[model samples]
Structures are given as C-alpha cells and as structure tokens.
Target: MLEEEYQPRRVAPAHLRRTEPPEAPFEFAIRTARQSDLPAIREIYNHYVANSTVTFDEDAMTLREWKQKFAYLDKLGMPFLVAESPSGQLLGYALVTPWKPKRAYRYTVENSIYLGPAASGKGLGKALLAELITASKEAGLKEMIAVVADQGAEASLALHEKFGFTEIGRMGKVGYKFDRWLGTVLLQRSLKH
Candidate 1:
C-alpha cells in the first residue's frame, strides 16, 4: 500500500474531540477504624507528607507510630474512622485528636482526613467527615478544629467548610517545607448544637 493512501487529510481539533463522561462516584463505607487499618492509613498520609504540603511532617510515619497514635486515641475515646470498599480495601480515613494537651482543651479536638489518591474526588472524604463529626459529637466533643495547609489543600479546606467549619485564623510562614515557606488555615466547628 502507498504511504500516502493511509494518511488522513485532516484531524479533529482538541476542542472537537470526544471525551467520556465523568465516572460515577466510587462506592465505599465509612466506619470506625480498626488496628488493621493503620497500615493503609499510614500509606495515604505519607503520600501527602512526601509529595505535598498537606501535612507539615517532612518524615514518613512508621507503622509503630500509627499504632501508638491508635492506642492514644482509643484511650482518649476519640474518633478514628476509615472508609472501606465492599471488598475490604481501605479507601481513606478521618480522625480526631485532642486539640491541645491540657485538660481545659479536652472538649476541643483537631481533625485530620487523608484519602488515597485513587479514592479522592469520589465523595469518600465527605462521607468520612460526616461520620467523624457524628462520632465526635457522640463522644462528647464540643468543638472540632481543622488545620489545613494554605497550599495544595483547597479541597480539604472546602470539605471542612462544607461541614460548617469556619475560618478561625491563618498563620503565615509557620512551616518550611519543600524549600518554601508554608502556611496554615485554621477552621473550627462547634459540635454542640
């Protein structure tokens, strides 16, 4: 066959190209986290630690550290939740820790949520946050605070706000990461009616 016979005279412009519809939201169930879920949770969190400024930690957390945290939260009666697929795969996690180390701050807690890259943008974060908030309230927590990074964490900020967290304050140049100064946006929601 002649080479010229196989060539197309024109090609569709990028704008005219067809694209598939967005995928339906992935299905997952949100429930209280168990000790077995820490490995997956650590993987999700360390992704942000190593690749993004979502968490200020410059080092990856070991499984032992996660277990220590799990025990601490369990002892304190705090909420540590996970989202899982029907097949038992870990999708994401959300948890609450004491906002401060003082007894006076016992009624206030800070929340952290992390989703695996593939699990993001599919309603898992929202589901985890909703379950976390309910669990926190049931645990007698009065306030839930979210300390979201100012950079590369817009989705987190929006997710927290969607659950009624309001901007309480912002701190600039408080964290140095990836060879740049990073900041944090503080948000708080009252768990009590």
Candidate 2:
C-alpha cells in the first residue's frame, strides 16, 4: 500500500472562488471486518502508534497480534467493522471488546475507532461509530466505554458525546509517552437493545 500523500489543489483568487462548499474527498462503505483486512487495519493503527498519544501504547502491534484479536472478537461475537472505499482501500476500523475479563462485566465493552490520516475531518468516524453502536446493540452489549486521550483527542471526545457518551471520570498523568506526561478521559454510553 502506498503512503497517503497530501496534494493541495490550486485555489482561485477570492473573487473567482465558488460560493458552494467542497464535497468530501471520497466515499466509503462500512462492513464487517474480515481476516484479510487486518493488514490495512494494522497500518492505520501503527500510524497512530508511531505518531500520536491517542493510544498510550509505545509499540506498534504486529499482524500476528491483530489476527489473534480478530479471532478472539469473532469467538465472542463482538463487532469489528471496517470502512472501505469504492476501490476497496480500507479507510478506518472500529471495534469493541469486553470491558473486563470477569464474568459480571460481560455486558460491558470498550469501544475503539481509528481512521487513516487522510480520512480525518470527514464524516467517516461518525458513520463508523454509528454502525458500531448498532452492531454492539445487536450483539447484546449493554454499555460502551470510550477512553479518550486528554490532550490530542478532542475530536474523539466530541464524537463520542455526539453518540450520547457522557464523561464519567478522568485520570491525570496516568500515562507517559513521547517523553511527556499524558492523561485519559473516560466516557461511557449506555446501549439499549
């Protein structure tokens, strides 16, 4: 897969600029994630692993780990979804896993969503999260949790709030990455069947 590049389009002078707004860069379709999609999914995730504090993990996930995760979620009947373009390039992915390993927490899950660099600022995250919520409801999950980064994840916080997630708590300086102290904001949404 080629690395996504930013190509700026030439803009007309203000006098000649069109009054209409521009359309999104591309359209995408959301579907259940297949084992074959793991590579692209891994690429999208590693982009964050290498560059951002959105995820606290310092090491990039290996494909073997992704396959294991896919298998585990499949066995548990959890929702794992991917957003693909018309030409079939994966744009992003979202999934939910058991919030805790104990039996009493079976009905609760933690949600995660990641998009490629080029896919941000579009409505893809919203679309993916909406589908994830529906899928989670169908899977009999009663609650969804979002652990968002306190510093660089404002958009993530807003997206979860748009879906009715409420801020439940926060942990200050709980993580250290990139030679700096970071924190997490905990948000939760109740899922109704």
Candidate 3:
C-alpha cells in the first residue's frame, strides 16, 4: 500500500477555472460542479454503466446517492468539476476520491473522468482532468491514482499517461460486469511537492 501525509489546504475556485477556451465556438465552459448539476452528471455516468465498460458498476446511481457523494466531496474539499455549455447544459465531469479510507492513505486520491457521448474527442476530458490535477496539488495531495477498467478503455488510459501517470499494477479477473470478467489497471502519478 502507498502512504503519504495529509496536509489539507484550501483550493481557490479560481485555480479550478479553465484558462484556455476551446478553439471552436462549442458554447461550453469548464467550472466547479454545483449541486444542481448532479442530475446531469448521474445521467452521463449511468449511461456509461449501462452501455459501456467505462465503469465496472452494474447499477445506476440514484439522485440521493449522487447528492450524498457530492456533499461528502464538498466537505472534504476535493476537486469536482463540470463541463457545461453557456446555456447551462452539462457535457462532462471529473473528480477525485480517496484512494483508501485509512488515514495513512489520505494524500493519495483516485481520479475519475466522464464525458457525454457527444462531448468526447472535443478536449473536454483533457481540460477537466488537467484542472482536477491542478486543484489536487493545490489541496496538498501527493499522488493521484487511476483505477482503470481493462476492457478497452484506451482513451482514458492515454489521457492519464499524457499527464505523466504510469501503470503501477494490474489485477486480472478482479471485476465481473457485462457478463464477463474484467481486469483492473492501477496507474499512478506523483505530484512531487
């Protein structure tokens, strides 16, 4: 197991802002997630759970469950972001969660990024993850982890690699979903402080 110190710090909302806008007039903006965005976030996530191997979960999350998750992250002050159009349509989201609940693992967090089908390949995933890492560093996180599903999630893996993450471990047949067993790849990226 990996361990690091917990030195929580305040992350300014501005640090989570997107510095560069999309070249095309995509009518989208990246910003911190709000409570109201939970429904759309759930929809996007559930769509993946039901139709793709992006997530290993077999069931969709309820609104209350999503709200609870958002509240917990808010209290912990972890980074959670949303990609939205100017007219308030949610396009995608990215966030981080504790790698493990033990105190020794506090500085290590796992990252997650999800994009709506129509929003993929438009730089939203990259932009959102870049901001997530920046915010995690600002919050004094030492390591970011990605627990990837092994069923052809290349784009997600590539995104992490582009951000300097390296494959640290892989467990075969650790997850069973979509009527088949799947592997889990652990990727790690250290934020040297």
Best by lDDT: 2
Q: How high is the lDDT of residue 2 in model 2? A: 33
- Model 2 alpha-carbon drift over 4 Å, by segment: 1-25
Residues 46-160 of candidate 3: C-alpha lDDT, one tens digit per residue: 9998998879989999999999999999998899999998878899999999999999998999999999998998888889988998989998899999999887799998999
**Which one wins by TM-score: 1 or 2?**
2
> What are the C-alpha RMSDs, in order, of all predicted structures?
5.2, 9.3, 17.9
Worst 10 residues of 2 by lDDT: 1-10
TM-score of each: 0.87, 0.88, 0.86
Give per-residue CA lDDT, model 2, range 1-193, as digits (tens). 3334422335567898778877756799999999999999999999999999999989999999999999999999999999999999999999999999999999999999999999998899999999999999999999999999999999999999999999999999999999999999999999975
The RMSD (Cα, Å) of candidate 3 is 17.9
Q: Which stretches of candidate 1 lie over 4 Å from their true place?
A: 1-25
Rank candidates, TM-score, best first. 2, 1, 3
- What's the lDDT for candidate 3? 0.90
Top-down lDDT ranking: 2, 1, 3
Model 2: pairs clashing at backbone N, Cα or C within 3 Å: none
